[model samples]
Target: MVTKGAMLWLACTYDLDGGTLGHLRWRDEEVRTVILAIPTSTPQCSTSFPDNYRIDCNLASNEVRLGILNPVHGDTYTCSVYLSDATLKGWVLTQVSIIVPVPNVTLTSPVSDTVTVTPGDSQVYTYVTGSCRPPARIDWYKDGVNVTNQTGSVSNDGDEFVTTSSFTLTGAKDDRPATVQCRASNVDGMTPVQSGVKTLVVQCPPEIPTNIQEMENTETTIIVQWTEGFNGGQPQTFVILYRPEGGTKTETVSVIEQQQSTYTKEITGLIPNTRYLLNMYAYNVVGNSSLSSVVDIISKTNQECSYKGEMTSIPNLASIALFITSSVLLVTAVFLVMCIICRRKLRKMRGRENNPVAEAGVNLPLSPVGQHDISTERSHYDDLNLEEREPPSNYECLGSNAAANVNTQASTDDRQMYESLGTRSNAAVYDELEGPASRAHVII
Candidate 1:
């Protein structure tokens, strides 16, 4: 027995223990242990025994603490450790502490915005979750609902989370706006943080035209027009498909790229009052759709059998007709002005040709009349003899028989080939017209 104030270490131990006094039993398939009660009120009982006693197993690793109920220098202590079967107990009683749960969660990336995906395009997103130590698991939702499909989407690949939530639109639903979201979870399911809404918009292909209109009365061909909604991007091409308004698809139809998105279409070989449908589709580089829209064109018949006099018709709408007439007259005046300009140019050209001889005459020197001839009588030959004049330094062709006179320096080949014009003695005259044989001058 240990005294109340006496420090007593493990003074003794017992070899055998049963379930009676805190003898631990595994109760299942595990460790069993035992707890020995060291009494502080009986120090003499403890020290009175021998310091060494045999414990069945080594007890080196056991926590020691002052007894909770007893106040002593070190008379008694309590130990807590793994319950080993060697001692006869199955489990150990360990100390416990209370921990408060953290409620703060952080999300990164995948901002709150709409995701635009063309037809046949897969949408991709990136995000991460945070709390305090253990990371979180992420999940995606569509239209405020959870995604439970395993094969089609939401799979883990080397720590990278991906989804294949593809929505088919063509031949089904046209482009409609949808939403996508992300959810995070931890060990405690109570607190879950959902990311901001991510809007997803899907698209589908376009359909053919319905009703069409025609100009004048034409049965075989009609000008079809339609109103088209805004298609996302400029695609490679738009396919123009057409079929009879109420006829079967087996009938002769048309499909071409040259006839895409044009408001006016020429539908041929159709009977009068027949109906036809037209479809157009525009696509982007990635082949996404929501292409051009379609409309129907209705054909009209050709019928004309009336002739009304313009005099009566013109009188009724004279004011309006005059306004139109004035506009036409203004255009006609502009055309007349252009014609007058062209005629004046032609006349100028004609005048140049007609007066060439007169100009040549003016260039010639006046012939000397006889001084003795008092004959004031005008003669027809008076103007005819007006010839002998100085020739231009640059050669001018007047008469076919006139001799060409060169009057300046020229190449050595000049005098060797042709004789001079002024005289045989004045050979220098012909040399100037030859210019330089080394250099060739182009003549018109």
Candidate 2:
């Protein structure tokens, strides 16, 4: 076998006395008849052939030679010789098989250098080899790795064979922007021709957001932050879903800023001293990713008290003001009541000092009938015992002057006893009543 565009020669020889080389035929066509034939003497003849072919006849050597400048496959040459004895004749034939190296390789299906495809989708790439002999062998490659597992088909268009190879590529996230190429080889020991690189861009949803956490929080607001994941070859946005723990209602917020390594969002309108559950999701044009790991966060408490898993809000300004006003009023009322009581006791003591009849009745010993009357009277004055008492007119005084002196003595003794015991008892009662007023004043 010879390569295309190479020189090839075919010769046929005969050993017959008085024989001459007649003519050469290629593929059942006489070479001299198709082009120009040069007649020569008995020793030699020549022909000019078509398509860069030459024919020579040598009667001395009894050989005929056919010269092909650009040989192609499926070419046949036949030489016929005539002997001097007409009964003997012979012919010789030679067939040509030429190797056609692959000329050009190109991707026909994906004409452009780059193609965009969705993940999990299939893409077909077709590689065609230029017309060649002995049909070229086609191989597929992805990212410089050999993946030539599929068979190829070859068809003859006139004289040369064209090889077509198709490779199906499945789009994947990990293999994004993969480079695919096709190589064609026809001749042994010859380097294969490769098509231009075709880049496969696999577009998919963004990856799940990671490392979600609470950055800061206030009574009604929380600031959340997270590490952004792969955007899947496109711009992506993040969504946050938050809800109070064990609550049925859910709220959502979105972060629309582009191309951030770390994303942050502030969530407002939250309840204080409440536990919240949160999750994040990434979204793109293709689709949304799965929700990220759940995050547990708690909002800060206001002026609140927590007791036994229960929360109570502190009183507001109005309630505090009302409480202070009520305490002040109560303290004033208690002070006024104590002052009225002290003033009434002072008035009764002054009346007892001015009237000697009431003073004498208080110190005088009583008969059974008088004692009963006194007891009945004392019962009506049980709280203060300050009611006016008149001495019995039937009881005789010692004499005017003697009675005056005795009365004076008795008044002195009673005054001494009252000053000793009555003063102490009154002071004790006053102290007991004053304790509450002092405490109320302090509270006010």
Candidate 3:
């Protein structure tokens, strides 16, 4: 069947020697036509036809044409041929019908409006219409709400019209999986056709955690903890950075797949008696957060007191023993050296006490003048010769020069007295002694 407003043409073939009348019938009215003496024809639509219909006829060719055909004209259409000649049949008829089709609606572009976007961002979207005999109207929806902010336009293709709808969307907090749709409709009032549902995903960066602290500490490790912060509406992971204070390089530790509101992490492989600076940050699908303020901490230095492991290795025990032995040896050696030095000084003092005269040397005084050299004279007397002579002992009265006129005389008693005085050879009498060179009296 022909569509509404389409042209309908009908032709009848006949054997004719004379002029004929051709009429087209639609509904209950006839389409009129006139044939002149020539072969040309004039056609007119009947009053029952649509107001915009036009008719044309070819009498010579036995054809009729209907323009702007409408369903209102009728379901059945008959084109008739009437003959003016008696020999021809009275009527020649051909029939057809007209039909108006239902409008088809579809979406051509943006099969689905689902998309991913950063939080607090804006985006542009395009929706196009699929092929439709009659142009379809496009409508936009966001979050299941009809959108009026956008405008649509139509363009012609080979046999159908395409409509495109474009719009801008500003992101919001609730934009995660935000649904968007494009619906098409026509005058038929049938069910509206739509594109598949679309979604806008909103991702965000992680927030900085709060109140970080060193929960536990030791010589070689520390346990860190903190209260969690907002996760930027998404899952997050944490990164911890630590370094020795005033150090140029840093060490890193990571915490992943974390979903809790608080956290604790242990850091190991550190040095004792060292200072450290610690900071932390978090990250998610969007980006990383700002680094937290750094904290200062000092590791314990007293390994023996603070370390948990035992110092039971052979080398350590041996070192302890060696240290004690060395200290004792050093003290003993110092004491021995001091004792030797003191002993040498005491011996030198004793030697000075033992030889005082020898030590005086030539400093002694000489004998006094006019005094006999008593020791030297005593030594000479001991050296005198005393050999083989009988003793004569006597008392004599001498003159002034008695010693000059000496005589040998002795009394028996005097001799006996002399004999009583033991002598190997001697003559002795009472007399005066002499000094070294001058005479002096002596009693004998």
Candidate 4:
């Protein structure tokens, strides 16, 4: 395939029509020179190719015989057809080449042709910006003012330039015709050829969760619950902090990203009955957390309180109010029922509900008033107990009182059954305990 001139060693192939049209591509369509030359000079094929390479080409035959030719011979001419010994005509043919234009562009964003963004708030804007060439620069503008954000770098994907522009709102005031226009140009400092603008609807930040509740009393656990996080986009992580009483330093308790709709953390080694400052931050990747809400945890046995807020899923204020009303009624009903059962038990012991803690072993005579008998154990209940009690612990007892009502009806055997259920299964509501002794409940 070596040559004296600048011709490349392009392919050289020959096709004979067998049953279909053969495929052949030639750069220079002009036939240089062809001959119907009969091979009589060589004893056989001097070049070792088929001898029919010279004398076989039929233009009229739908199926014809064809062969290749060697271009190595000198410029002299000796042309003759095979069998007939006639000279073949040497004519030139030309081929034309054409390229089609690209189709119309497609718009991927702003389905309604307008986008609504907030002022001073940053939002990541994305688009499939494509063109004949790479984009020089892609910028998103609003109302002729540049919408700024944390812009990521763009790379060429096929015939498109991909970039995510963070749209920051220094002042995305209410009802403003906020426009998100993605301008894409091929070269830097050039005019944007394909651009789209969408109107933005800017609003205030979502309201923070109300009525934060903290579970304390256990020397090693803290449970925080609130109304569901802002029901806008996906939920964000919860950042919690703990500051001991009388101390200014604070420690981050946890950063919960997934399953942030609810939060419950078991903090070990916390002091019993001591008050700790609690703060909760609800956030997501795209938005900052709502204002930090404060709560004080008081470790106590089965403490409960009502959380304040309207539910997000429900639409009717009346329904929400009705729900709150019903919940209160239910709690009050249980409290009354518990008060009844507790009074009956106290009557059996012939004791007051508010008996002093020091009276555990101070009585003169051991007595039984009814079938319900009060028997004193030989040793103190706290002495042999391995579990640590968070005496003096402070917490928002959201469910404790109601739970006490439910638990009071159950016997010690029932409590054991519930404890087994709580430990065997994952920590769900089943793990929550009731009554004054419930604060001692731990996972293990």
TM-score of each: 0.30, 0.51, 0.44, 0.25
Better of 3 and 4 by lDDT: 3
The local lDDT score (0 to 100) that residue 318 gets in candidate 2 is: 71
Query: What are the clash counts of all predictions, listed in order?
Result: 33, 0, 9, 32
The lDDT of each candidate is: 0.40, 0.69, 0.56, 0.43
lDDT by residue (tens digit), candidate 1, 336-369: 9999999999975664443343344321111222
Model 3 segments more than 4 A misplaced = 1-117, 133-151, 155-161, 172-179, 187-189, 197-199, 203-206, 227-236, 272-275, 283-287, 298-444
Q: Provide the lowest-lDDT 10-residue window in model 3.
A: 357-366
Q: Model 2 lDDT vs. the true structure?
A: 0.69
Ranked by lDDT from best down, the candidates are 2, 3, 4, 1
Q: Model 2, range 76-115, lDDT digits (tens) per residue?
A: 6666655434443666667788888899987789777888
> Candidate 3 or 4, higher TM-score?
3
Report the Cα lDDT for residue 7, model 1. 33
Highest TM-score scorer: 2
Residue 39's lDDT within candidate 2 is 26
TM-score, structure 4 vs. true:
0.25
Clashes of 2: 0
